[model samples]
Target: MTVSENDTRSPLLTVRDLAVDFRTTDGIVHAVEGVDIEVYPGETVAIVGESGSGKSTTAMAVIGLLAKGGTVANGSISFDGRELVGLSENELRKVRGNQIGMVPQDPMSNLNPVAKIGTQIAETLLAHGQATRHNVNEKVVETLTAAGLPDAERRAKQYPHEFSGGMRQRALIAIGLACRPRLLIADEPTSALDVTVQRTILDQIATMTQEIGTSVLLITHDLGLAAERAARVVVMHRGRVVEQGPAQQILNDPQHPYTQALVKAAPSVAAARLQPQVFATERGVADGSDGSGGSDGFAGSDGSGGSATAKPIDNIVEIEGLTKVYPKRGSKEDFYAVKDVSLSIPRGETVAIVGESGSGKTTTARMLLKVIEPTAGVMRFDGQDVAHLKGKELRSFRQKVQPIFQDPYSSLNPMFTIERIIAEPLEFYKRGNSAQRRAKVRELMESVALPNSMLHRYPSELSGGQRQRVAIARALALDPELIVCDEPVSALDVLVQDQILTLLSDLQRERGLSYLFISHDLAVVRLISDYVCVMKDGELVEAASSEEIFTNPRDPYTRRLLASIPGNELKIAS
Candidate 1:
């Protein structure tokens, strides 16, 4: 798969001096500028960058699917000996999905909601002239099966809402490959999926593309993943090509500062385990403090927390035999979203719950946050039974325990300014007068490292990281003792993710904040957690210190998850 210069297989797709522009209310914003890339026959190329770095813009221009107000400013996109810039919509339709297929980022938005999954695939195949009405259903089943979806026939009959995240992504892949195009553009294909499901999707893409001799152009923010999947890695920053080279070369010896920072910030599963002892909690009790503060020196972007060890460990939140069950629509037995789960968060240390999408991690977090009522078992917060709290007591518990959700874009209300958003929590709690609340909001913003300049700006204007900071600031506005962070950094770029992790570590050290960090990423868990809890199928498979979980995982499911971390294969081979 090493595409040598001398190995002159003609480029399947080529872009020369490509530039894309969007017509904003103010003026024309140059989104992509002077970008050049090529994918040779059967070669896989990855364009990697942070959000708004023009990676997605470049791909959109190539496929003639630019959003409204966007147009190709200047570019020569020659695909298989033909120029695609000036093609009419009808003409482009003849070319699209027939010769150039695309698997868009979010299957939820990309896939039609009202239609059956089978009919959606049928539309693609019929539009591309890949199938006649007589054989389209058979083709649909074949395509879904090839994309790694189980019970393809039955799944085809279901609606998208009925499908799981991974299953929906597979359906997109099935549609993308239905026509067997000469080239496929997978845009952030598995960014929101679980690590194991991410691997399965990527593997399916590789297998299907290789079977059809189709080249690939992958677009992602994950450089480590690019290194593992693509033969060549193209690094883009600020609408320009910053670096381009072999995949391993980029990971092992990156030249550009941006690229180097990405590699440094990316948490590798093969990296050393971080050992954390307790930080001093508010109660002033010291648990066995052997001062075992072993660290890997993976100081996230802002470089915070070196060896923060602390005093006695107190259980800020505890759950014993917690379970949530619902009656199935047509089945005899109930469905357990979370079952027989017992976990505890130390007063001043992070306890991370790591699992796949349906592993009940988020469900556990919701129960702790009191978002939903648990069906079975006991839940306690700071020695008080959570299940028994009512009215004023429940309100008091909610004031002490806040939640930071997964998608900041959706978690934050677009109508509210940063100032108002942060002040709302204080206002609801009737903490102080208007003057005091405003001052507290500003202090909370500073704690999360957001500038005061952003106070009046709405969530629509700020970036993903900034909005997350706003969310964090609001969570801290309550001055809560325990914060349940649910996949906070999963949507961010590596550098932003690094900075957020560091900020969390800093806050925990300075304020003794106990975090119930729920994430599917083991790497992030290792970087920020003292204790790690592994979950599978609504059950706690393993619980131990972060070091012990990473170094000597006892559960087979835990081992499989560690193995599924992207780029683990490269580390193993090396």
Candidate 2:
């Protein structure tokens, strides 16, 4: 819990009384407030908070990327004793990539869609005057290789779409590290990636940063990753610093109530899915009592009320001999995204579909949603044939079942306010007019624990967690019998995920709703689902009650997944 040697009298970067405001039409939205933080040289500092905690805004303000209508109204941001508060955009841009580099959370936003990635990276080096035309390509290849991209020479010429999510993230990291800036700000670099890929990407950054002695301001909601990777932790709430200290201390002995709640929500996802007991950790204060490594295995509890609902064993939705294949002209064979898969979700019960990236979990969900027709399958929803349903029948089928997507950021329209986002579903079905819809929107917001005042705010104005809540509210607008929650809480922070999970559980119990929850985090699935279905290579490898699946994972893939989860006992030594 003690501060390490890196915490000297003077820091590499320091901020005091920092505040930001956006002059919107309605009023000024106080985004950040009276914030003070410091990042020492050769130290990694993680800013941890739920959505709307101003974590990303702080990072953006540091790099001068504050969005339209936003301005830093108060306080000072100093880098190496130089003030940056009143600096011009041109000056900030020069200082940004040269002295401070950033790796954004979503690669799609930062990456140029039309331009070649190699040329884009070369531009970064060229901007800083670090590489000539002759050496630029070589530098790009070397940097890409260092970022862990395979066939860096040829891959550099490819467009952003040609690369996978993890590779795209690596490419972004390559650009950020291209300048070899003294400070690197990585905002949720691994949020979209699977666990294995996440580990690999983070480890690459960790290794390279150490070799170059680059300080990192790591902003993410994943407490497990923060605990594993960061040296120091800063917890922010409502744009203020709630807690700040050593990563081990914050993870193991968090002082603030908010910090304690977040730490308690860190799940060993793999272990929990395998068995519930792994999640039963003793609650302790700063002294770290009940020491058995003070680690909780999976059961990924969202700090919600504990109650078990008994349900019938019959599958509410059943798919038999499900096969989906896409045929390309002149091709010898079709692409089997999902092949002969069978799965079931019990009535008023939660069923989780889990797998690595591109393992067909989403494809299965799409087939269930009927967005994409299955090439061959016998699907039943509420004991009626669904695969055969089309047009009006399909519309009615959709009414019975709804879907919550992985990224709420993209799910909701940027132009719409919170009220519009929630009301779109109600209006589509002609459920109510303006006044009724407004009332329903308010009720939905209350149900999702979003502030009623947020109804008028745009998606760009809200934080990550808040936006997801808006998405949840929109999903709940139809009051469907079952919802296909696809990574509903993945983009959220530990505490926010806890709140959302608790809300979903409460809603299900009160409304008699069922869920087909799809996620990569096994711990989340274990906490929310009554039944677990593990998928691998377009096949259902294991399916059982939560208790049985966790207690006795039958498949080798399931066992390996349980083994890979980050647990308290598996702490990487400093």
Candidate 3:
């Protein structure tokens, strides 16, 4: 395809008929095939697709960071009128951080854990000959501030572990844009960040790139984010470019089946959970299930019936002035992680606690799950004071309430097979014998939509979504009445996230379970939660029904959070 007359200028980066393959024990795997994309000077082009769809592979190949045994079998990659396919390691190294900066997906893994932030940033500048030892410190602080880190001097002295997730990501952005590269490739840059933090990080990138006239190649699975951030969109599926066009045009009226499915599956696009008709007609409901009444079995929050109702629900768990504080090292002062926050979870309904990192959402969840004792508060579960529970009483409380951690990869025992992982709970509770435990494991797997064939596989072999399913199955093994889910779907792609939400909703209806769903994605919160609690800096800013909070938010923070949702400006085609 030839460039249009309007965009006739030579592109800063171009990939024509790019094909990438990886040699494995079984055979060669085609990771990318006949993929073509272009990013003109100062333009932002996004590659959107599901996991394993070759989006990241294309980016990695472009920057010559392909894994071992991976090769560019065919096609061309041109950067600034320079061919990169056959470049040697030394040649590619010079082009990598100097000419083409890259902000990887996971900040924790990308940033050197032992190094100070300032040293890492200075190393990038020094390696590229952008600064001298005398001025490296100054340059590091400047870059850190440019990446939106406040108090760069103090922050630079800390390591990656000392910073929050958003801050760590900002540090990486600083490293990526330190030398003012001509092109930047951000691979799922803010996938795990809160919506508000995500907006700020992306905005920082946009401002810096635009100021320097640097082009961007954004690879993400979020269609909404792609539409809002990039001027042009390239949809990839199974290593092929299925469609490419203007961002708004593709989002509002997607041409390909895969693109349409992505738009429909994105919860951020629909705004509300019960309003399936808004984006349903385009390609059915987001879950790809029948749109019958309460298809997921959960009623709307507006009292219609099914999973939710307008009527006041019975309070299954209630807390008064919940507070958690950690002692400061070598000081009398304490760090207040959660301060005087109070909320309630209604029986058979979902109450979501929404906030950014260190905003007390997760702290509150940990307190509820009995993982941590509250500094000062009163918690009543099923009308029983849980703060004083001990011995058998505490054990009884634990069996009635369960927890599904955020990272499925880290939460499950990697060495254990799927069968043992799920059945461990049954064995611990002594609910059944070996035969009965195996049978119960199968039932749990089926409930979460996993096949019995995967029972023997370890967590390492499962996809992110599948691992989360295993976590859910384990959580339900004991038939807990209330479940605490901390950032459950934040790491999943839109399709897998949709499926998990649907499964949670169905399970809630079938078993009348109450959920304390903690998350930063308001879109996901709106989809699954009947009630919403907005938290900030260890305090509850706003609490109301999901509809009221989204439609008529009273708090400024709530309004800002809603506004920051990606693709909020675009109107989805009905």
Predicted model with the maximum TM-score: 1
Pairs of residues at least 3 apart in sequence or in different chains that clash in candidate 2? 51-465, 269-523, 272-298, 272-299, 274-550, 275-550, 278-297
The 10-residue segment of model 1 with minimum total lDDT is: 294-303
Candidate lDDT (C-alpha), each: 0.85, 0.79, 0.86
Tens-digit per-residue lDDT, 404-507, candidate 3: 98899999999999999999989888997889999999999999999999999999999999999999999999999999999898889899998899889889
Candidates 2 and 3, the one with greater TM-score: 3
Model 3 scores worst on lDDT over the 10 consecutive residues at 279-288
How big is the positional error of residue 191 in model 1, measured in Å on the Cα after superposition? 0.8
RMSD list, candidates in order: 5.4, 7.8, 6.3
* Model 2 spans > 4 angstroms off: 1-10, 21-30, 68-76, 81-94, 265-312, 328-331, 390-396, 407-479, 548-556, 559-574
lDDT of 1 by residue, 195-298 (tens): 99999889999999999999999999887789999999999999999999989888888889988888888887666533345332322322113332212111
Model 1 local distance difference test score: 0.85
Residues 446-534 of candidate 2 have per-residue lDDT tens digits of: 98888888888999988777888888788889889989999998877777677778788888877878889989887787778766777
* Superposed Cα deviation of residue 249, candidate 3 (Å): 1.3
> What does candidate 3 score on TM?
0.91
